[model samples]
Target chain A: MSVLVVIECANGEVKKSSLEAATYGSKVAQQMGTTATAIAIGDISEENLKHLGAQGIKKVLFDNDARLKNFVNLAYVKVIAAAAQKEDSKVIILSNTNIGAAIGSRLAVRLEASLATNVVALPEISGSTFKVKRGVYSGKAFAEVNLTSDRKIIAVKKNTIEVGHEAGEASVENFSASLTDADFAAAPKEVIQQTGDILLPEADIVVSGGRGLKGPENWHLVEDLAKALGAATACSKPVADVDWRPHHEHVGQTGITVSPNLYIAIGISGAIQHLAGVNSSKVIVVINKDPEAPFFKAADYGIVGDAFEVVPKLIEAAKQLH
Target chain B: MKILVCISNVPDTTTKITFTPDNKQFNTAGVQFVINPYDEYALTRAIELKEAQGGTVTVLNVGEADTEANIRKALAIGADDAIRVNAKPTDAFFVATQIANIAKQENYDLILMGKESVDYNGFQVHGMVAEMLGIPSITPGVKLDVNGNTATVQREIEGGHEIIDAQLPIVVSAQQPMCEPRIPNMRGIMTARTKPLKVVEPTGSATKTEIDAFSLPPQKTGVKMISPENAGELITLLRNEAKVI
Candidate 1:
């Protein structure tokens, strides 16, 4: 039996989160003295599928049914089940993304595997018991969970694991699952692509702002810094609620939860709700005019200053890095 | 139309999280619990739909007696009846199994909940329930509209949103922009006390996962106060010291 990694591809390339999952799956496979095989979904090129070997995958199974390009819940689950059966996979790993969550849970039931989502660390396997650590309470606390079933499924949280880059090549094979018209019943009428290279969920570094940036007109401070660092741009709930930024960019309890390696928060008071979404960030840097801003207490680094002045300097400094 | 809205009771977003003395469970002594903020959106939207389509809205919870208050609060906001499955939530699989069993018997037209609970943050229940029933599930929904047996839902993707069309018998996990959650009015609150509240035994699906322990994230070291004038210096440290850049 091999470990199977579900690789999510967008725009004909593997997503950063999926690469992290591949890396994690490969590590888990190594610990089990087995190899990792990846099942590719969404849009991806054959050449790029082979490149997933960089993340330690030994082989790739892809469904080129053109119709499988967009996410169809049942169809995706069917494809994964076929792969799991073909590979005799006991452990399945995927990114804890929107697509992953939607499909992973269904696969757990269809496969009768013990399921764990939002997992942050590698599993600790001792004899028959396999346990994993996960973020819970919306990043407030952590829980060590033991999976009691023979088959297991894990949805790794984004940006929680470092991706391995051991250059290698993986063999690609085309596999087709039995599909019918029923599987396409819930397909989207249209797919809208976000207009940016960096996706917030996959971004390693995120530069975010809150209402302290003043208004929509002042969002340039956030955008410029993001551009300088090649990072994703995000905003707090207030900014998104007030229409200063798009809802997709909002990162908070009610929005998207992101755990980037380096999170830069500017002009945002650390609201507990806001922190709930980003508290898992590895290194948090807060820049606010108020020294006593609650976010400062949670920040690894703090700069007590005006966003107008501090952001431009940060941008200038970030540009010089390259 | 019959709509089922699921709600979870969780600590208020502002509650300072602390573990029990043994560090194995959440310390709930002084913490204030509220209807999960995201679930509020689902409850509000379900109520709005019921008003428009003349449907019965039912609120369901999987927890012990402590969660009944929030379930009743949901009734006061808009549901016609409430159900409390008598079991502490063990994991997403168990919770979803319980909900799916209840929904199967009742045959609700639409099932909705928040994208994820603020406490456990497990975004698995909706999909699992749908899978158990062999139905369609949409998550992190930003917009939803219904016309008889068809539903038009707008859900968040990585960059933008996708508008989907599904037949009746669908599960959707609501998020922001669905609608502003409504507070319970005095009249609704008064009427809620007399509404039918049903307590059911758990489906007894053994939890596949067990929590070994709980712990708070390590406290952040004191923030190094970097002067605004030398903001560039902080960047240097980030590069040379932190090596993040």
Candidate 2:
């Protein structure tokens, strides 16, 4: 049986999260004594698929139909189902991002496979049963899940596992599926991407602001720190709705959920909604003018001081480290 | 309008996660299960929709006999009926299969579910179920409106949100904005006891994936400080010593 990895691409390049999924799926295949086959979606090119070899992907199956370029639920699921069937895959893997969560789950239903999202580690396969550990309670804890079905699907949480790189030449092949126009009927009408260096979900290190910076104009301190760290910038929901930061960067219960390896919150009061989004981070550092900020309760480390005084120092520290 | 709300029985958000001695299964010894937080949104929203439209709300769960309490709680919250699939939710596929099997028989106009479970967090069941049934699926849907057989949904995208319109028999996975979960009033809890909870045996294969072991993340080191006035020293420490800048 084959281990199939679903890889999503944008701007003709594979997303970083998908690369990590590829690495993860390949590792799982290695442990299972199987080969890792990747199924690419969206506008990714063949050259980019070849580059995925560095992550130990042996082959990539690219669906190049123009109708498949956009994020359409029916079309994407059909494409993935077709690929999994063609490869006779026993396990399917992808990143636990918006697209992956949306598509991977539907694929599981069609394939009648066991699925686990937000999976943090490799599977524990003993005898015929497979088990995986996943983050739960917004990262407050972990749960070991057993997938007794023969077909399994896993959506790896972003930034949870390091991407493995090796030197190799992967075989990239063009895949043609017998999909009808009905599958493409629900294609997205538009593809809009937020323009910035700081993408919250894709960021390795995220620098978030709360009520601490005092005003929107004072956001430069937060921006500078994020720039120096090459990390994404975000804000709490209140900060976003109040116009201190754009709504796109809001991370909370009603906003975007992220699990970056390192999350730094400045001046945020750490409301439950806000913590719910980022609590899954591997390391949480809180910098608040008030030592008793509620968010500090969940922080792995804390600093009781002004973010204005602390952020620039952090930027300088990051630059020096680089 | 006939609405089917899917909820998963999982440990409370505050539960400490652990594995069994062999690490091949979840350590359920001290775990107190609760309705998945996300699914609560779905169940409540479905109830609210039914209240507004004078339709019926049905709560569906796939689990063993122990999870029937949660199904009853959902009924107490406002559902007209509850369906319990007699099986363990070993994986997303197996769970989705059970739901799809029930859906095939119900022919409901709208299917509602959580974005993901609090425990396994598969996040795939709703989409998978929708696909299996060949219906429109909008995941992480925050807001929903129903008019006759037409439904409009607001689904969260990466940076913003999208407004979508689809006909009846669609699948929508509810997140926070769907609705605030209603606490069961004393009267509702009492009425829930008599509501019909039909249990159905699952028609699916056994699970495939299993757990290997559980290991807690390394405990973090204590905080180190460079005096408040010497803020720059903290930078030096991060750069030279901590090396995590």
Best by lDDT: 1
Tens-digit lDDT track for model 1 on A6-43?
A: 98888888888999999999999999999999999768
For candidate 1, the docking band is: medium
Model 2 chain A, TM-score vs. native = 0.92
DockQ scores of the candidates: 0.79, 0.31
- Please tell me which predicted candidate would have the highest TM-score against the true structure: 1
The sequence of per-residue lDDT tens digits that candidate 2 reaches over residues A100-193 is 8888777766777777788888888778878888875555456677776678889898876788789996798888677776675444444456
Residue B71 in candidate 2, Cα distance off native in Å: 4.2
DockQ of 2: 0.31
Task: Give interface RMSD, per candidate.
Answer: 1.3, 3.5
Score every model by TM-score. 0.98, 0.83
